[model samples]
Target chain A: MTALTDDTLPVTSRGMRDEMIVFVVMALLLASVPFTGVYPFFVMQALCFALLACAFNLLIGYGGLLSFGHAMFLGTAGYCSAHALKVWALPPELGILVGIAAAFVLSIITGYISIRRQGIYFSMITLALSQLLYFIYLQAPFTHGEDGIQGIPQGRMFGVLDLTKPTVLYYVVLVGFLAGFLLIFRIINSPFGEVLKSIRENEQRAISLGYRTDQYKFLAFVLSGTLAGFAGSLKVFVAQNASLTDVHWSMSGEVVLMTLVGGLGTIFGPVVGAFVIIAMQQYLASFGQWVTVIQGSIFVICVLTFRRGVIGEIAHYFRRSL
Target chain B: MQALYAQLLVGLINGSFYALLSLGLAVIFGMLNIINFAHGALYMMGAFVAYFLLNLGGINYWWALLLAPIIVGIFGMILERTMLQWLTGLDHLYGLLLTFGIALIVQGVFQNYFGSSGLPYAIPDQLKGGMNLGFMFLPIYRGWVVVFSLVVCLATWFLIEKTRLGAYLRAATENPTLVRAFGINVPRMITLTYGLGVGLAALAGVLSAPINQVRPLMGADLIIVVFAVVVIGGMGSIMGSIITGFALGVIEGLTKYFYPEASNTVVFVLMVLVLLVKPTGLTGRAA
Candidate 1:
C-alpha cells in the first residue's frame, strides 16, 4: 500500500511554490550535467525511473489503487524485448514493441482479476499474480533461470542507429522518458482523467452516474503497466541485463517509495522521488545490505513525517499541481 | 501410491498453516479493516523465539509453543497501540503501508542477527520418529502439527461464533461507532483483536518450526502464498479462510505430486481462475 490521497496539502502555500521553483532550477541544472562530462548513464537511469514514477502516479494519485506487482510490467517488457532481440534477431524497434505488447497483454489479464478486489486486497492480488508470473519466468526455458536473457544485442534502431554507443542509447531513453512524462501530464489534464479523479474521490457517486468506473481503473492499470514496461525495456538496454531482480517484489516497493517520496498524487513528485532514491542507492551501493535498512527507514519516515513527499509537498505549498 | 499419500500429507500439513494464518488475517481484517503486512514477520518471529528459547533458555518445545504466541501477541498489541491506532478514520491503504514498514523493520533486524540461512528447529523427543501405515509413513511432528493446528482452528471458530466475547467482537466489527455507543470500549477491543490475530499467526509459526527450518526469510515467502490463500478464500467469512486454506493446500500438494514444475504457482493460478468466475470468492459473501 501507498500513501493516502486525501492527506495531500494544498500546493499554493509558500513552501510549495519555493519548492517547485527549486525543482525547476534543479531539473535544469541536472539537464546541463551531460555537457560537463558527468556520466550520462547514471543520469539516464534516474530519468527512466523518474518517468516510471510519473506513470505510476496516474494510478495511485488519480485512481486510488496501490498495485504491489507493478514490476511485472517492467521486467516482462525487459524480458520480451531481450527475447525478441535474442531469438528473432528483430530490430530494436520491434523488440521494444514486443516488450510493450507483452506487457499490455499481461496487464489486461492481471488487471481483470485484481480490480475485482479494491484497497488492500487489490494490492495483494496484484502482488500474487505478479509472483505467479515470476515463477513462470523462473522455470520457462527461455528465461535461462539465473543467467536470464543476457548479452542481448541492442540491435540497430530501424536497422541503422548504433546502440552500442552510450550517447545514442542515452538519447533514446531520454526521449522515451520525456514522452511518458508528458503523456502523464496530458492524461491528468484530460476529461477522462477528471473522471478517474472523481472515481478516486468517491466510486459510489461515479457509479451512480453510470460511469462504468471499473473500466477506467482497468485501463489506467494497463496504461501504467505498459509505460512501466517501456521504462523496463529501456532499462535492460542500458544495463545490458534483465534478471529476476527486475521482477522481484522489492522493485515494486522501490517504485512505490519513489512515488511516495516524490508525491503520491502530484505530477513531478515521482520524478524527484526516483532521482533521490536512485542517487541514494548509487552512493550507498558500497554499504551492502544496509541499503535495505536505509530504504525501510525512508519508507517509515516518509509515511510518518513527510506524507506529502518532496514534490507533492512542494507543489501543495506552492499552490500548483507542478 | 506412496507419492500420492506423501503429497496428501504435505497438503494437509500446509492446509493447517494456511488455515491458521488466514484465520488470523481474517480476524484482524474483521475488526480493524487493516491487512497486517507484518503478520508474516511475526510468524517468523514465533519460530525464532521458539528456537531461542530452546537454545538459550533451555525451554522444551512444549513450553516454547505456549510462550512464543504470548510474546508475539504482546508485540502485536504494542504495534496496534503505537502506530496502527493513529491511522484510524483515514484511507485503509495507510494502514497497510504502516504494517509493511513494520514488517520491513522486523525482518531486517532478524536478518541482521540471523543471516539468511535457516536454523533448524529440532523435533521434541515426545514427537520423534515416524509411524508407518503400510502405504505411507507419517512423521510424529507432522501429525502433531496438523492435529494441533486443526484444534486451534476449530477452537478459534468456536470462540468467535459461539462465545460471549466473540459476540462483542462481531458486533464491534459490524459497526464500531454503534458498538462504542453501547459502551464496549471498542477501541481497546480492536487493539486486542489485532493482538489475538497476530497471536494466531505466531502459533502457526511454532507449529511450522519443527518441519521447516527457521530462517529470517521463511515467513516472507510463505506469507505471499498465504495471501493467495486469503484471496481464494474471500475475506467475507471466517470458515472460508480455514476451509479454503486446507483445500488449496491439498490442491497444491497434489500439484507437486503430478507436476512438480507448477507446484510453486498452482495456488496463484487457482486464484486467477477463482477471480475470473467468482470474483467475490467461493465462500465469501458478495461485496
Candidate 2:
C-alpha cells in the first residue's frame, strides 16, 4: 500500500540538491536550443504541455488526487486568453491574467464539488464537470462552435517585446514554464505541502491530527488548476488558436499519460515525460493513427512494468528523488 | 405533445443503455474493485464483433447478440488472467490507470482499422420499422431495445441478488481471504466476475449497434456519461443503479424538450447535485 502511495514518498535534502542541479542544467540546455537547428516552436509547445503535466503532477503526485479531467482548466484558460486577445484587444499579459483568473474561479467551484468525493468518484466528478464544460464550449457562441477562436494575436508583451519573433515567443513560454515549475517546487517544500501529503497518506489520521484535510486538498486543487491554466494561456500564443481539442477528454488522457510516463510523484518526471511524448508525436506525425497505438502501448507498458517512469527509474537507481 | 412523447421514447432508449452499462460497472467494481475504464472499449469491441460477424462471417443479429458477448467476455477473462491479475492488492487507482491504458489501446486499434465514420448494422427483419400510436409514431426497434434491456438488467440483478453463485460473489467481495479459506477459488471467481461484467457491456453494444451505427469511438464518450450515472447511483446498490440510470435518462429527455441546450448536461448537473447532497452517492457505502 505504501508502494502505491508514491505521492507521500519522503523527500530528502540530498534529493532536492540533485533536482536543483538537474533543473539548472536542463534550463541552460533549453535556452541554447534556439541557437541549434532544433525547431523552437516545437520546444515551446512541449514546454507548455510539460508545464501542464507538472501542474497535474502537483495534484496527483503531491496531493494524491487523480483528476481525470484536467483539460478543462487548460481549455478554459486558453479560451479566456484567446477571447481577451481577439475580442477585447487586451495586451498579452493581461489576457493571460484573465485566463488564470477564469481558471482560478472555475477551480474553486469545481474543487468544492469534487472534493466531496474521494478516490475514483473524485476522478469521475472532475471528468463529468469537464465534459459539461466541453458541451457548453461546443455550443456557446463566444467559442464560435467548432471553429474556435482562431488566429489569436500573439500581441506585444507589455508593449515592448514583439512576440511575433519566434525566439521571443519561445523565451516567453520558457519563462512561464520555469516560473510555474519553481512555484510548484516551492509549494511542495512548504508546510502546506506536508499537510497535503499527510492527507494523501491517510485522511482519517490527518483529520484525527486536527488538520483540515479537505481545505488543503481544495487549495492544492485550485493551485494545480490555476497553474494548468497558466500553461494553457501560454499555449494559445504558440498554437494561435483555442479549439475543441484542448477541452476534449483525450487531451485530459494525454496529460495523464505524460505525467504517468514521466513518473507521477517526481518533480522532473513530468517534464521528461512531456518532452518524450511530445517529441514522439512530432516524429511520429507521419505514422497517422499509429501514434495513438504507440502512445497506448507506452501507457500499458508503464502501468504494467515501468510504474516508476523514466526519471523515476533513474532516481530510484541513484537512490535519490528527481 | 407528439414531440414530447417522441423525446421521452428516445430518453427511454438511452436510459436502457445507461442502466445496462452502469449495472456492469457496479458488478465489476463490487468484485474486482477496479473501475474498469476499458468497459467502454469493451462495449465498442462488442459492437465491432457483431459487425464483423455479420459482414465477414455471415452471422445474423440473433447469433451475434449471443456470441459477441461470449467472445468478448472470453477476451476480457484472458485480459484478467494476463494483465489485470497483477494489479490486485495495490491501490485501486492503479487498476484504473491500467484499464485506461488498455482502453486507449483497444480504441486506437479499432480506429486504425475501421476509421471513425461508423459502419451500419442492419436491424433484424423481425424487429425493423415502427408501430403507430395515437400521439406519436413508436419505433418498434426502439421499444424493443427498452424492453429487452430492462429484461437483461432485471435478470442480471436477479442473478447477483437472488442466486447461489451471487451469494458466493457477495461473500468474496466482503472477504476474499475468508471465502478462499472456505475452499472456493477466489482468483478464478474474480476473473469470471470481470468476464460477466465485460459480457454485459458487450451485450449493450450488440443491442445498440442497430440504433447507433457500429463505430469504434462510440463507447468512448458514452462511457463517461455512464461514469456520471454511476456517481449519481452510488455503485453500492445494484437496483439503485438501474433505477437511477433510467430516471436520469428520462430527465435528460424532458430537458431536451424544455431546453435542448441542457439535455447533454442535465445528467452531470444532477450528479453534482447528488454529490452535494449525498457524497457517498444515493446508495453507496461510505469509503
Candidate 3:
C-alpha cells in the first residue's frame, strides 16, 4: 500500500488545478457512459466498489491505517439498508441513511478499540471483529442465515424518482459516488487530512508536534467506514440482495486489491482499479477459480513489481499527485 | 456433565489447532517480522499433501504426517527464496499483502481441483477406538491430538527458550546487523525459521485431516480465529501463545456447552475484552 514518492511532494496550486480538471473530466466521462450502451448495472456495481475502495484508500493512503475487516462496514450497511427497505419499507434515501448510520456506529466502536494498537495488530483486530460479526450474522434471524436478505425493492428516491428504471438508478448511484468522492477529496485537503498525513509519515513526530494522532486516525477510520457503508447500501439497490459474501474477509481483501491496483494513495486510483477488477470479474466469471488465482497473481505482481499502482505510477511519472 | 465433557473435548481439539497455528505465526513473526498470512494456506496444503500421499502414493497416515510437513516446509523455503525475500526491509504490511495473495492462489488452485466438498481422510488403524471413563467416551484420536499438540507446543517452547540456536534467533530478531557482523547467516536463519513455521502449520493440518475433512477452505476460516488467538496472547512470547491457545480452547468449549449459539464468536469476544484491558496483549512487548 505504498504511496507514490510524489505524494510527499508539496501540493502547488497548479497541481491542484490539474487535479481538478482531471476529476471533472473523469466525472463527465462517467456521466456520459449510460448513453454509450454499456450495461448500466455493471457500471453501477463498479461505481459502488469504486466508492468503497475510495473510502478504504482514505485510511490506508492518507492515514497509514490498513484495515483488513472493511467488509464488516459494507456488509453491516447493506444488511441494515436492505432490512430498512424490505421490512420497514423506508424510502431509498432513508434506507441508505440507515445503512450509513449503522456503519457510523460500528466504526466508532471498532475504531475506538482498534486505534489502541497500531500496524499489523490493527489489521488483525479489525479482521477478528469482522469475523465475529460474520458469525453473528450467519446465525441471526434477520439475515436468514444462508439465504440472506433478498429481493429488496428499489424504493423511490425522495418519494419521486422511480428507481426501478435502470438509467435512473445508474444516475443515482453515480451521484452518490461523486458526492462521496468529493467529500473524500475535501477531507484530504482539510487541516484534519494534513494531520493524518503527518501521522502516517511519522506518528512519533506528529505526537511530538502536539497532535493527538490516535484521534486523527480514528476519525479517518470512521469516515472511511461510513462511506464504505454508503457504498454498500447503494450496492444493495442494484444487486437486490445482501448476502454473506459482503461480510466475508475476501470481500475486504477485494477492496484492498482495488485500492492497491488503482494506487493506494492516489485520489482516482481506486476508481480505476475498481472498474478494472469488476470488469475482469464480470468477463472472467466463467473462469471460476482462475479468477481468484488471477486476482492473487495481480496482488503479488502489484506488490513485488509496481507498488505505485496504475494511477500512482502515472502520478510518479508526471511528478504530480493524482 | 457428559455433554460438558464432550464440549470440553471439542474445545481442546480446536485449541490444539489454534496453539499449533499461532505458535508457527509467533515463530515466523519473531524472525521475519511478517505475520505469515500464507500460514493457513500452507496448513491446508499440508492436509492436501497428506491426502495426495495416501491416495496417490499408497502412503499411510503415519508416514504422511512426517512427510507432508517436510514437503510443505521445503515449498515454503522456496517461496521465501523467490518472493518473500525481496520484501525484507519493507513495511510489514507488504509481507501481509504478499502472503494473502499467496493464500488466495493456493486455496484457489486446490478448490479448482478438489471442489468445495471436503474429501475424507480416514483414522489410522492404531488410533481407531475410544476410551470410556464412565462420564463420557473419549475418542482416542481426539485425546491424542490434544496431548500430542501440547507436547509439540512445549517442545517448541523449549527449543526456542533454551537452545543455542534459539539464542541466535533471538539475537537476530533484536539486531540483525549486529548478528550479521558476528558472522551468523541471519538471512538463512530467517528462511529456515519461515520453513519451520510453515512446517508446524502443515503438521497441524496433517493432525486435523481425519477429524476435519480435508477441504480447500479449511484453513481459511480457521486462520482468522488463530489470528484472534495470537492477538490475545500477544505475539511476544512462545509460552504465552501456547498457554493462551489451550486456555481459550477450553473456554470456547465451555461456551459451547452453555451457549451453543456463541461458540463461534467466543474467541473474538475474548479478544475484544483482552484488547480493552491490555492493548499490548497479554504477554506482548509494548510496540
- Across A178-264, the per-residue lDDT of candidate 2 in tens digits comes to 999999999998999989878877888999999988899999999999999999999999999999999999899999999999998
How good is the docking of model 3, by CAPRI class?
medium
Runs of candidate 3 with Cα error greater than 4 angstroms are A1-14
Scored against the true structure, residue A15 in model 3 reaches a CA lDDT of 58
**Per-residue alpha-carbon lDDT of candidate 1 for residues B1-287, written as tens digits (9 for 90 to 100):** 89898888899999998899999999998988888888899999999999999999999999998999999999999988977787777777776777777777888888888889989988999999999988889888888888998899989999998999999999988988898888889989998999899999999998898888898878887888988999888887887888999998899999999999999999999999988898878888764
Q: Candidate 2 at B93: error in angstroms? A: 1.4
Residue B217 CA error for candidate 2 (Å)?
Answer: 0.7
DockQ, cand. 3: 0.64
Specify the highest-DockQ model's number.
Answer: 2
Measured against the true structure, the TM-scores of the candidates, in listed sequence, are 0.96, 0.98, 0.98
lDDT of each candidate versus the true structure: 0.85, 0.92, 0.93
Considering every candidate listed, which one attains the maximal lDDT?
3
True contacts kept of each: 0.49, 0.65, 0.69
Query: All models, DockQ values?
Result: 0.53, 0.73, 0.64
lDDT of 2 by residue, B1-287 (tens): 99999899889988998998999999999989899999999999999999999999999999999999999999999999999999877778888888888898899898988899989999999998898887789889999999999999999999999999999999999999999999999999999999999999999999999999999899999999999999988888889989988998899999999999899899999998988888888878886
Instruction: At residue B5, give the lDDT of candidate 1.
Output: 87
Q: For every model in order, what is the number of clashing pairs?
A: 13, 0, 0
Which has the higher lDDT value, candidate number 1 or candidate number 3?
Answer: 3
